[model samples]
Target: MTTLTTPTAARLAGITRTLSEWQTADWKGFLHPGDLGWNSMAGAEKSAADLRCWTADGTVVAIGMFDGEDLFRMAMDPAALDDDELARQIEADLTSGRVLPAGTVTVEARGALALRKRLRARGWNEGEPWTPLRLDLRTPVPAHPRDAALRVEEIGLDQADDWISVHWSAFKGTPPSSDDRRRLVHRWTTMATGPFAHLAHHLIGYDNTDQPVAVTTVWTAGDGRPGLIEPMGVHGAHHGNGYGTAITLAGARVLQQHSASAAVVVAENSTAGALATYLAAGFTASEPVTDLIGSVTQRHP
Candidate 1:
């Protein structure tokens, strides 16, 4: 494997735009606009690409960022490295100041276990701290939504405020500014046509007067891999009507129509209580991956 780093000062949007496309295309929803879990190296913006690796022939293989000696989103193409090769790369990254505090990695179950084993063998054991779970799309969902009043509808940009209000009210004390909410909704609307969003359905639930009550966003990797549901939310007052489950199936139907093999689902450890909603929607857990922050090397003595 060959690693390449370029030192340049360019607009953050310009550099990260390519990285975002690369992620949306190749990395399968790993570095989304909402996830700020990456390590920053050479002071690169957290939302953009800091370092990229490619196969000898120049095809990109892995992409990551570093903050001090920590790393995050260290995804590598399996065909390019064996266990020893992987270990060597990790070590080089650690000692060379290429990675920083948030430096961590995640892969599919088998791959994650393999890397975890390699890191352990190399004395990198902080812990198995994060347990991220995924939902496979190809599986058949229960034939129906939870109820009839639970209507699933596309959230137009005009009605973005309605959706925003639900989130604002849900979070209550921590409401964002109007501009922030506008940008947030714009991104969601953009996701309706995003690379991943291109083949999927994005939906929201509404109450009797057509006000949004719940929201769930789903999309595919464009490789027929499966669909993924993210940022699923139900307003504070509408929690018990099975709104979450109904909309989840609505998205699953879209996946099933595409002949997808699985749908992926993830929730941080703090949100374990919501896992039951997914379980009730006919989703089975594949594996749970930890979501960790800070650093073992820099923070630990």
Candidate 2:
């Protein structure tokens, strides 16, 4: 019997392990374990609270994370991709509000054909598309000309503040409040010390004036598995300076050092500039994939 339950710390670790094993040289648009690690920015406890797993015979077969109140991103074991029992169980829970609220919900299940087929039969439609890009780590990552002038550093606890500063400046575009800063610090601490810490690398780049201008976090599933660049950004003030490409190449180099088969990231199709940055860093783009959108009220029997 397949049962759905919120994960405890042990179960979450298991989910992370399974996700790592699921990564492949071929991009499948599945959830990366780094996605879970990135969510640690919300704090450890909250990250756990937002996760759910489906288990059968004492092993996790599917994992899901709620990305906000309406979007649920999920990945299943490759063996379970076409499992009808698991698909029906997931569909029922999703529609019955056991997993998400009883209303509109967006599910990112690009690799789960059975679940996606069920959702489509029940009236789900495609959401916005996202482009997946990858850099082969078998070859040395070509250096960007900007690499010559920028100093990239692998940061730790002492430099957590630097990471937080540039990350917020790049994404939020304003100074974070004291409370927000405190929370961001806690988030970084949790991630850096978490169970999967060995797989993570935090890097920050500085220009000639020693100003931190960009940041990236790279996570490896393990040797030979694809590595992920979950959230890479250049400070808004430094956008036109090629810092984005510089930081991205820095990340790919870290992945190669860790023996990753490839480095992968996803960008919303709307973010043309982000895609261009990866291209500039020697990454190749794959066909885009879209999330499945459905309303609970329209659930079919």
Candidate 3:
């Protein structure tokens, strides 16, 4: 039987660490270590509380989390993708509503999953397309990419406002609260000594006026492994100035310095401009990943 378990607060960190260990660059469109890191940094208490896992003979074979009432994000063991019994069990569990709440649910399964088709057969519609992009870091990054006019530098607590302001401007309506910022800094501080020490990088790009215009946060899975640049953005006013590419190059440089094998980022296939920015930053595009959506089949307590 496939056993399901909700890891407790004490076990959450270790669970994510194990998931990170399970991550490999070759596996595309799956749950990622940096995804866990991002959620943890954003709201550790809430994230830990929402995580769940499926085990086979006591070994965790699948990991998942609910982003709210409607969306579920998951990644399973690459080995188990071909396991018919396991995949059927997973599909049943998910649709049964024992694990997820009833709703018009959306599921993002990283990489290709066998369960995807089963969900489709059960009335799930294929959702939006997302493209993954990568930059090789095995070779030295050019000290300067062509459009390097913006001054980019690594930042810390003292310059949090610089980073936050650009982030707030980029994300306009959904900006984080003051308390969220405090927790983020605290999370960074706590990561100082672990394997995650070299994982997170915060960078800010400045315009000619010395005002922060762009920001990027890169997280390396481990030395010589793939690193991800999540939410790299340019200030609203600075959107057309090439700041996005400059900041992205800056992020890739940071990953290279930290021994990353490659730098990765994902963009929606529909976002032509954003995709163009990453391509301009020298990232190669890959096949797009699609989400699976379906209404809950039952209700869970």
Candidate 4:
């Protein structure tokens, strides 16, 4: 029998453990352990509050997290990909207004074929697409002469401010306020100190002038499974200097050293430049995946 429940503090660790075990070399648009770490930017308590899990015989079979009030992202255990009953239960909860509110909502379940089929049969439309790119790390990464001018460092707590500065400047295009700095620091600290901290690497790239020009965080499920590079960015003022590719390669190298089978990243299909950067770093693109968009009111019985 299958059951659905939100994890408590004791179960949170188990949920993360199950998520880590779900990662595989074959690219799937599934929810990643890194996604949870990145979402911890809001705080672990809030992340737990928004997460739901489906279990069979005391083992997790599926996991979902609400991205804000409207987007519900999920991943199913690959072994249960064809479990129709589980898919139906997931769809029911999604449209029943108990998990998400009663209105239009987006579901990202690219790897969940059974769930996707159910949503399509119910008339859900496809949303925007995202491109997944991956680099096999069985071989050593090629070194670039140009990257010699950039220094990549694996950061610790003391360098949290520098990490926050580059992240805000790269993504927000503005200087971070005191409150913003505090929040970003807390986010980094929470992940750095969490149960899966050993699986994470926080990296920042510096130019010849010693200015922080790029930043990224990499997470690995374990050896033989693909690692993830989430939230990679170049400082807004330094966009044209090849920093994005350099920083990406830096992140990939960390994963390689850590014994990850490959490094994977996803970018919005509309962001041609971001896709280009990953390509330049030797990541091959895979088929793009789109979210399913639907209104709760239109759900079929």
Let me know the TM-score candidate 2 reaches against the reference structure. Answer: 0.94
Q: Write the per-residue lDDT of candidate 4 for residues 1-301, one digit (tens) a residue.
A: 7787887656777788888788887869588888887776555677788799988898899999988888999988998887899899888888776577778999989789899999999999999899888999999886755589789999998998998899899889999999989988887887788655777899999998999989999998778788999889888888988888998889999999888899998899999999999998899999999999998864334
lDDT by residue for model 3 (1-301), tens:
7998787667765676667666576757567666766666434556666677999987888889877678888878878876778879888888888887887889888564678877878778988899988888888664445345788899766776667778877878355688967765565544433333345788999887888889988987777677888878888887788788888989999888887888898899888878998898788988988889888857976
**Model 1, C-alpha of 94: deviation from truth (Å):** 4.1
Candidates' TM-scores? Answer: 0.69, 0.94, 0.88, 0.95
- The prediction achieving the highest TM-score against the true structure is 4
C-alpha local distance difference test of each model: 0.52, 0.88, 0.77, 0.86
**Candidate 3 vs 4: which has more TM-score:** 4
Cα error of candidate 3 at position 4, Å: 1.3
- Candidate 1 lDDT over residue span 259-300, tens digit each: 655666665445665777777787666455552333234422
Clashes (backbone N, CA, C under 3 Å), per candidate, total 30, 0, 4, 0
Better of 1 and 2 by lDDT: 2
C-alpha-based local distance difference test score of model 3: 0.77
* TM-score for candidate 3, residues paired by index: 0.88
Model 1 poorest ten-residue lDDT run: 33-42
lDDT ranking, best first? 2, 4, 3, 1
Scored against the true structure, residue 112 in model 3 reaches a CA lDDT of 44
Candidate 2, residue 117: lDDT: 91
- Ranking of all predicted structures according to TM-score, beginning with the best and ending with the worst: 4, 2, 3, 1
Pick the winner on lDDT between candidates 1 and 3.
Answer: 3
Question: Which one is best on lDDT?
Answer: 2
